[model samples]
Target: MITNGMIAPVNLTANVNNLNQLQNKATPAEAAESFASFLKNALDSVAAQEQNVHKVNDQFIIGEANVNDVMIASSKAELSLALTSQVRNKVIEAYQEIMRTQL
Candidate 1:
């Protein structure tokens, strides 16, 4: 969530004596909605990049685009997909860890 080359600071301090109050900071529904929206946006961006690659490839075939454009688009799509996969893996790992916590 960087804006204008500046990263926003996050307030992550937790009151060690008030562990129970932490759960009230964000409702499960609100968290879910935000997470779902973020994931949908990320997936949509990746899909758009893939489509761009395809379009560039087709344009190159028709002599309307150069190899450089096609290559750049392909690389962007590849990187985005790879990043998405890594994020998915990390999310799965975090979920599994949370499931393993003792009550």
Candidate 2:
């Protein structure tokens, strides 16, 4: 079990070797496709959460769901949206940074 405030130890050299191997083996197109796939999955998850919140809200309105369930669902949807926005902003930032590179 992981304890609170605990940091897992990592083998830095192994990680560097693994990353170098990936960089050498993977083509730019493959990397782009992988990133696109990951982004799409994240978006789908956020959409799913939003749909769930809507469903819970409707249920609550119909007296089938409790206030607590509605609140939790809404909060989860809001958090998912916030995370998606942050991730998008970070990707944009990275793209801009790459554009500014001389090489």
Candidate 3:
């Protein structure tokens, strides 16, 4: 258990070594690309979850799924999609604001 206000010291040499390995294996551009790809994947996952909820509802309509399960899945998917959209909107707003800065 971690106590409040207790900061653990990180080993700088180990961190440097890890960074060296990462730098050796990938350029800065490659790292940025990987990060962007990861973000895209996360967005895709949110959309997929929404699709799955709709699918469950469709299954229930066709008499292949339970009502309770469909409702639970749909609520979960809806909440996830809403949260993802909010985060995306915030990020876009921040980026636009940054672009508006003249320095």
Candidate number of the best lDDT: 1
- TM-score, cand. 3: 0.65
Note the residue pairs that clash in candidate 2: none
Q: Which residue pairs overlap in candidate 1's backbone?
A: none
Q: In model 3, which runs have C-alpha deviations exceeding 4 angstroms?
A: 1-26
| Candidate 2 worst ten-residue window by lDDT | 2-11
Query: Best TM-score goes to which candidate?
Result: 1
lDDT of 1 by residue, 1-103 (tens): 5321111222224222234443554787765665566567668778887888888788889898787777777877888899889999999999999999999
Better of 1 and 3 by TM-score: 1
Clash count in backbone of candidate 2: 0
Ranking by TM-score: 1, 2, 3
| TM-score for each of the candidates | 0.71, 0.69, 0.65
Put down candidate 2 lDDT per residue, 3-59, tens digits, no spaces. Answer: 212112222374345445545545888766655665566677677778877887888
* Model 3 C-alpha lDDT per residue in residues 1-103, reported as the tens digit of each score: 5321211222237434544555555578876765566566666666776777778778889997787767776776777778778988999999999999998
**Which parts of model 1 have CA positions greater than 4 angstroms off?**
1-26
